[model samples]
Target chain A: MAELDEIIHQPLRLRIMAALHALPASTGLEFARLKKLTGATDGNLGAHIETLARAGYVAVDKAFVGKKPQTTVTATAAGRGAFARHVATLQEIIAGKQP
Target chain B: MIDSQQASAALNDINDVVHRVRQSRIYQNASLIIVMWGALVFVGYLANYTWPPQGYTIWAVVDLIGIAGSIAIAAFSGIGPGAGAYALRLLVAFLLFIAFGIFCSAVLGHFGPRQMLVFWPLFTMLFYALAGLWFGYAFIVIALCSSALIVTAYFYAGPALLLWMAVVHGGALILGGLWMRRI
Candidate 1:
């Protein structure tokens, strides 16, 4: 949950995680569509996504799709576990738990 | 300075975690919509018997198409985008509409008075709603507009249907556009 204090609350980060986690991993264009779906811009989505990738919570692969360089992102096992605990923590807090 | 780096790292992690949860929710919502639509289609078929024509054969064929298409979509969700699958959804929905027109006009012709077909718009509306909720808001809105046109042509005539259809289409697309923009 303390790790989540570092991760979840930012708008763009929330969106990138939401996108990658859903498809597990998808192309940069796919992520961009999700970003648009969640109303975030390219720079914003990239920066937040980079932060997660750097944390080892997400893994990003850069590859070629036809002639274009594409990035695909996926959540690590650690990332999934972290997210579940974070949700549990939030639920606990909602049910009147103290820090 | 050290605290600032730690804070930034913490925030990034939080975002990563929460976003995954949100996407999972969207996936779950999509599944629910599919289930609900299947149920609706089944019930609609049951009600189809009340109409003038009891051509179980054609209705069964139409129902198979619907059921197969729904299963294909459900299966495709697991296999990622499935290439041109999204476009196929639109094509399938359009074909269904044409079949609906043929079925109602030709087979159900003996419904006596046109007033009894009041269920036409209602049925089409429900279909569009199912498609919209399953596919996207745009699909539902467009389907509603198209189906309304069919209803108008059959039940009413002249420019009134045209004017009303314009209004219906305009309102649906406008509302859907605004909703998408909001999202």
Candidate 2:
């Protein structure tokens, strides 16, 4: 059985990855919107996002929409691949296909 | 340390996230756009009957108004990145459909504005179906009903056809928007 990805194993990060993966490739969600979806506090969400970014699992892009600084997060191709593998591993375990 | 129980929990977590995202109002902006255009078309058809001699002029004004309104709504539709990209693609598809319709009409020459009315609803139905499929299943029902209305309009022409289009196409969009909002 494939091992779980440590980067995506945390509950909050897992939810974040799941939401991003649901979208089409190269597409992203705004930071505020993501916070609403994940129900995570700003500091908590930012920390997990930072960890994922460091692991090359997600890409964070910051820009100014007018004068307000807006941050958008997209799952990298590597992140998507890792998430897929992680999900598959979970499924395998759930199905009792892995000992 | 992650056993089957943990695995099951993770799967549920993933499912919850996907469900929430799908259920979110990411396409609210596009939905409102549809409602706006539908209203314009409805009012335009009503005006066509109300002023029979100026049918052509009424339609021209309606088209111009529609173009302007669409530009305004599109500018204000504050959508997130992913949903915004999808909406942009839909816009491209809509423009392409209009171009194709115009080309075909020019080439065919024999097909009059009445026939184009029928074609318009069919195209609109197709677009609604695709959009509904992407956003939610409610739109699929709207698409199927619009198809029925399209068939009805095709068989009956003149004032009666316009009325039918107005009632069905316009009604679907208005009602669909309300329904989405309620959800």
Candidate 3:
């Protein structure tokens, strides 16, 4: 059985990764939007996002949208691949098929 | 560091996130396009009924214009990649349907723009049904109503047909938009 990705195994990061993975690669959710989706406080979410970024799992684009700050977070190709493997590993564990 | 129990919990969390993503605003913008085209086509059909000779040309021009507007809206909507890709596919399919109809009209040499009344709503409603199933419930109602309208249009002649199209297609779009907004 494949080992779980330590980076994606955390509860909050897992939710973020899953949400991003559900979207197409070229698309991303804004920071505020992702916070709502994951039910994370701004500081907590920012820290975890920073962690994921440091690990090269996601790409963060910070720009001005009509004056206000907009941070769009998209899952990189590597991030998506890692998330897929992690989910598959979870499934294996649930199915009792991990070998 | 996640064992089986935590792994199960994590899986559940993933489901929740996925559900939230689906519920995001990325897909809501599709309703605006639906309403726009719906209103446009209704006006076009209404113009046709009001002016007989000029109605066909007006409807054709309006239809093309609506397609162009939809393309622009889809381009700038900031919708997710999946919905964006599906919109592109839908456009290609719509164009092919139109092309096939034109070819048939050319071959028959003076029947009618059967594609407009007959195939247009049929294809539109089919996509609506699919989108409704994927997106929300309002679309399903629109799909059924449009299907009924198309059937009714098939029997009606000339001005009456356009009237039905206006009422049914346009009505569904506006109503669907309103319903989606409530959701």
Candidate 1 lDDT by residue in tens digits, A1-99: 333445754555655554555553432334545565556777877887788887777877788889988776677877666656754555445444534
Q: What is the C-alpha RMSD of each candidate to the true structure, in Å?
A: 10.2, 7.7, 6.0
Give lDDT tens digits, candidate 1, residues B1-183. Answer: 124444445445556644644444344434443444434443443444344265345445645675556555555545455525754764677568757765776688645333333344456567767856764565565556646654665566543433343344334434443443333
- Tens digits of per-residue lDDT, candidate 2, A2-85, equal 888998999999999999998778879889888988889999999999999999999999999999999999999999999999
Worst 10 residues of 1 chain B by lDDT: B112-121
DockQ of each: 0.15, 0.37, 0.40
Candidate 3 CAPRI classification by DockQ: acceptable
lDDT for B66 (candidate 2):
66
- Per-residue alpha-carbon lDDT of candidate 3 for residues B89-162, written as tens digits (9 for 90 to 100): 76896698677656655565444655456566676687778877877667778788778877877776554787
What residue pairs clash in candidate 3, if any at all? none
Model 3 lDDT, full chain set: 0.80
Off by over 4 Å in 2: A1-99, B1-5, B67-75, B81-91, B154-158
Q: Model 3, residue A49: displacement in angstroms?
A: 1.9
- Output the lDDT of residue B59, model 1: 49
> In model 1, how large is the Cα lDDT of residue B115?
35
- Superposed Cα deviation of residue B40, candidate 2 (Å): 1.1
Best by TM-score, which number? Answer: 3
